[model samples]
Target: MHSSLNDHMTLLKEIAEFLNEETEMETMLQGALKKLLTRSVFASGWIFFIDGKGKHKLIAAENLPPALMENDCRSMKRGGCWCVSRYHNGELQKASNIIECQRIEQARRQSEKSSGEITHHATVPLQSGKEKFGLLNVATPNTIEYDQSELALLESIAFQIGSAIKRIHLTRQEQEIALVQERNRLARDLHDSVNQLLFSVTLTSRGAMEMTEDMELRDAFHDIHQLTQEALTEMRALIWQLRPKGLETGLLEGIKGYAEMLGIHVVTHVSGVIQLPSRIEETIFRIVQEGLNNIRKHAGTNQAELFLTVNSTDVLVILKDDGRGFHAGKIPGTLASVGMQSMRERAQAVEGTIEWISAPSEGTEVFVRIPY
Candidate 1:
């Protein structure tokens, strides 16, 4: 009998191990209850989870139809109803008969009144540490009574269920920690990258202003010098916007600012959302900046479209231009020295990805997605 009880404990642990890896808490609880009932050969069993209103939610049960599992109340007199009070007081028990139960007077009173057969019962409460999560109920006919061994088996199973609950809680905590670390890395990379690029452009502009002499040539040089200065300014603005400003004012204002400076046809779509994390919003902004730069330099188109989608766990940004395009597969140059590489690095830094669509004459499209 000791050997058999040990085997039961092993089975209990196996069931809990299976449930612990599940993402949905509801599914894990139901699976644990199902396995418990099947292993013990109980005449009846039930699992109840507590709700916000302190009501019991019938998560799973045996000897009860699916729809009837919840919202069904039997008379307190029947041997069937000793569970509520036992659960309320946090008791685990193994009894040969309901008459021998500690609360026999109450059990008998309800049993006699319900007109239902008396059944032997064995039960245990499920918990994580000191918190009582719920109760497990099991019953058998009087002839098939519970011995000390059976009671021990029920206790072992309850421990396994509790362990699984704790494991899942730990997993979610780990995922959140990982997310925060990735965000910090991205913020650092953006600061390093944009600052260097803008600084070089600034110095180049200042040098050109001091080196020119011919009136017409100086004017042309001045125009180019101003263009470089503007690029530096754009880089600074893009960096500021990526640093986690609120969704409504930050992105909308940034887009409007870009439109005014570019002096081209720029249309933005609100689509189905707003509000994005600094890391995520920054990646999208960089991808757009790169795509438009490539268009202005290579494609010669004046009109562009920018679209953003912020959903439950992801942010998607798309920038499309009606300008001449080129082969992206043959992209050459270090990411830091080139626009395409910078965009890809920014996307990767924030747990995001980028996709490029372009041809020699059909224009270009840059699609970026960041998962938060």
Candidate 2:
């Protein structure tokens, strides 16, 4: 018994040391799982990460059965597990006997063809204080029951895992918030200094154009005025993209303002009220900005239409322009070359989808669908 206690203590120390190292969430979880397997008697284990949207994502797993891993672990990814459902429903707060493993039961039903041995598992909610991150599940092939000490050890590991996850999440949130704050500061500076200066230059150049009588001087002044005006337009677009003030009012209003700044007439159609998470809102705004930038640079038209339909589940955004369009198949170069890749990435960051459709001489269209 003393040896067993020493082993548990050593396991706890090792987990503490492993988690303290600079490692990503996945790596930390996997490393912890490896340590747990070495120190304990569990045959297999996995971790579910609950995201901001309250969706459970299976981030790490080890020694999972073939049936479960089939189809990209569709069953686990779909959140059909008994332990996860209990965790979501606030039933399983601490490590204890909850329900039989659904994967094991399914395998038992198909025992004739099942490949690996299965056994009952224990699950513990990984949480820091009141913030629940997810669940840690462990199972052994043998039919041995856990003692109080074993359960306590598992709970301690779960606590460490939860604390590490919370730290990682808070750090990421801080980084993202800092980035947004910096972007806002830069946008303000540009609007106050560069944007104002450009506007003044445009007005001064136009005044010179009107006052100059010589043809050459008048033409020179006119060119300068047009250049300044174009520069101001581009600068305004950049400022809006960096920090959209209109988003404070509404997404559609912000987008309309941006389009107008680019000298593009936008016809907006809205169906439902616009309500979304801030990250999703930022992604949609960036996507629209990229689309408008492409229109100004390549579309060769000053008219565009934006359609937004929001529902409880998702938001649909379609931006169409009647411009000199190119063939979608032969997109001159990579999608990154035309900013489509960045837009696609932003959409994907929110578990959204974006598509582009265009044909030579026919208008171009950008479609985006994001879940709230």
Candidate 3:
């Protein structure tokens, strides 16, 4: 009994240290599950993350029999099981004996080969106080009952996992808040200092153009006025990029506002609701901003077309302009400009794809698709 107690204490200490040290959510969960199954009596273990929308994702697993591991754990991925149903219904409150494993039973019925000795498992709600994250389950071969001490240990581990998840989420939220604050501060500084100075220069140059009488002096003043106005426009664009004003309303509105700021007329069409995570919204907004800026500078026309389609699975955007187009094939090796490279990198960062289509005379189109 003394030896068992010592082992349990050591396991708890190691797990606590691991959880505290790991910052990433998926890596932490997978590593912790591996530790539990290896050092403990449990023959197999798995974790499920159920979001507020009731979507269930199998986060991690270990020591699964051939049956459950088939087809990338398809048996575990789809359909509702007893424990998960209880979880969704708010009935599972502690580590307790759940019904015979539905996944095992299904696997048995489907395949003639022996499915494994495991039939029943303990289900524990992974929760920190009132907020619940998901469920953790562990099982052993031929096990039908779990002792009070074992159940208590499972509960303790579940609690640790829950607390770690909460801590990681809060840290990310705090970081995001800090980043927004910094961006706002920079935007304010540019607007107050550099932006105002550029405006003043534009006005002074325009006045000089009107006051000059010599032809060459007048032309010089006119050139200065034009350059100053262009500089002021670019400064405003930079400020808007730092703190996009219409992004709070919606992504479409934000894109429209940006195009307007760049003096480009965009005809937009939308298919679905324009709601997305902030990161995705920011990415798409910046890509469209770059596209519009290119149209304003190189397209020889300020008119553009934007098509946005968002569905349950993915988001698609196409921005097209009627401009003198270049050879798309030649762009990869010869004309890979920084703007094009930046747009491609942003799309790839979101696990998305972006392409440019153009010819010598035909218009240019930028196509972007990002999966949810």
* lDDT of every model, 2 decimals: 0.62, 0.83, 0.87
Which residue window of length 10 is worst by lDDT in model 3?
330-339
Query: What local lDDT does model 2 show for residue 322?
Result: 89
Residue 62, model 3: lDDT of 87
lDDT of 3 by residue, 1-372 (tens): 678778778888889999999999999999999998888888888999986656578998988888888888888999888988889888999998886988889977776656678888899999888999999999998899788878888999999999999999899999999988999999999999999998888888888878888889889988888898898888888888889989899898889998888888899999999777888889999988877777776667888999999998779999999887778877533223567888999999987999999986687899999865
Write one digit per residue (lDDT tens) for candidate 2, span 1-372: 899899999999999989988458888899899889877877778889865455788888887777666667665677467777777788888888644677666655644544256567888899999998888988776644677888899999999988888888888899998988999999999999999999999889888888889999999988998898888888888888788878888777888888877888899888898878878887888899889888888888999999989997799999999898888877535543558888888989888999889987798899999987
Candidate 3 structure lDDT? 0.87
Q: Which candidate tops TM-score?
A: 2
Clash-forming residue pairs, model 3: none
lDDT of 1 at 73: 28
Give the winner by lDDT.
3
Ranking by lDDT: 3, 2, 1
Worst 10 residues of 1 by lDDT: 68-77
Clashes of each: 3, 0, 0
